[model samples]
Target: MLVLVICLIIFMTFVMEVGSIAFKLTGVEPSNARFQALSALTGTGFTTKDADIITKSKTRKKIAMILMVIGHIGLTVIVVFAVNLPQLISSWQLIIGTILCIVTYLFARNRVFVDKLDNQIESQLVKKLHFKKEPIEEVLLINDEYKVAEVRLETECSLINKSLASLHLTSKGILVLAVKGEDRVILTPKGKDIIRKGDTLTVYGKIKNIEEILCK
Candidate 1:
């Protein structure tokens, strides 16, 4: 009984680790990726607006498919084991063992263990795309009418060496909220703040106009 319980715990951890790595490779941020991994492995199907990052991508969809398949298989195996357990043990000790197993399983899912194990596992995986970091939830801080986006600035763009005041981004209905450089973040930057190549610009504006301004 104890051996089976240990096996289940290991299997669950392995599944979540695979899910987390898959999410990171697809360009997801660390915290959100971990949550999505747990959601996927448990087959919770949690309603998440940010889930588009995973569900909308072809590569991420492949990971989600594998998780769903494994989740179903694990459920089936648990059901079969529960049905067959009575034949192996007939005494009241079986019931006590099951109660203890449930308690142990709950303890094994403790957040501290999960977080530590996740961090250790992630340290082994490569974090390659620093420039492609996902935007934080700054969009939610503003009113419903305004939206925020992070645009990665490339060298050789015409906007190089220009300050917000010189470019007059406000004239085009855009507001530069912040600039994230290689080592520091300039928040609510003044008009005199220069826009450097390789900086990430967090701007507020309509989706269409901002898309045109950045995607051009």
Candidate 2:
């Protein structure tokens, strides 16, 4: 809906230019007007065949810069690209608009996708378990400074048969805040509760020490 509204605004602005807004706004220089309109619509920085002539006025130059930036970022080049690409088959304005839109969107979307992927990888690591303990195996999860971390309970481990009170994890500065099982996370286990094999323990503590407890 937001994209549609913005694209509509751009289309309307383009249509309105046919009625002399170009000449009224920028005088007799048709090329400058065309450049400004294209910059405003696509957010591109390219100047016309006669850029030297338009650059004489400092005030007009500044205005051009402001409109260019607003057209590119505020109006959103990505949404414009997505909108104009399919419409270009029948209209030349849409064809030029779509080309510019695709270029801008590609640049922006790459950054967005990288950030999202980083977050997803972090989330998965925080919820992962260590099946067989090894120094190299410990490197898979994020460092221990992170408050939320996961550790897998092995069947032969001493804590497996003992009650929650018996292990005394707090003595080592670690806290087992939750136990993640097949279907749910147990935040508070009773004193007599015994950990089972394959249980994913969510621990909170210093990173180095957390690794120690998981490997021990």
Candidate 3:
């Protein structure tokens, strides 16, 4: 019975960790979904600020429901076993089991493990399970090959008064995604968007190319 309890604890930990990953793949942000998953697993209802976040989606809701059931069952079994046969297990078994449980918790919380595991899980789910999720590229655009940067227009720069169309920032391998002026922020600035001195341009593209063109 002691061994069974230990095995159940490990299994519950795994279920919770997997639930966290599933939440992320469903388009929830890492920090947010991780909390949601852990809370759901422990039957602790954290604020419902993102409640609809998990409940609206069929897949996420299913995972959350399973975690809730498993959490209640797991807690009940632990209590029943501890009360009925607390002395049956040796002290060493308790120490080792507790250590393992702690280690598993830390491992699951490590960011590196989360990222690598997410990639592997994402690949398998997409290829074999036909999992449909947002592309990672959409979530994070700045990667090894490209980056986003901000450039503040200097008063002396040649492009001070030019419109975006005339400057051809995109042609130079840089795209101006937004413009931050003294009072307002314009998203997807139009071609006729005038470049004003002191305006900050948020751009995305090859870093070196952007530096050569927009960063001038």
User: RMSD, each candidate, Å?
Assistant: 8.6, 21.0, 12.1
lDDT of 2 at 176: 77
Task: Give the TM-score (vs. native) of candidate 3.
Answer: 0.54
Q: How many backbone clashes are present in model 1? A: 0
Give the per-residue lDDT digits (tens) of candidate 2, residues 67-166.
Answer: 5565556456546555665654446555655765676467546877645744454344334621122221121234536455556665565566677778
Give residue 137's lDDT in candidate 3 (0 to 100): 16
- TM-score of each candidate? 0.49, 0.33, 0.54
Off by over 4 Å in 3: 1-3, 95-114, 135-216
List, residue by residue over 22-57, the lDDT tens digit for candidate 1: 676555554567688778777785686656666667
- Higher TM-score: candidate 1 or 3? 3
Model 2 alpha-carbon drift over 4 Å, by segment: 1-146
Local distance difference test values of all predictions, in order:
0.68, 0.52, 0.73
TM-score (C-alpha, index-matched) for candidate 2: 0.33
In candidate 2, which residue pairs get closer than 3 Å at backbone N, Cα or C atoms, i.e. clash?
144-207
lDDT for model 1: 0.68
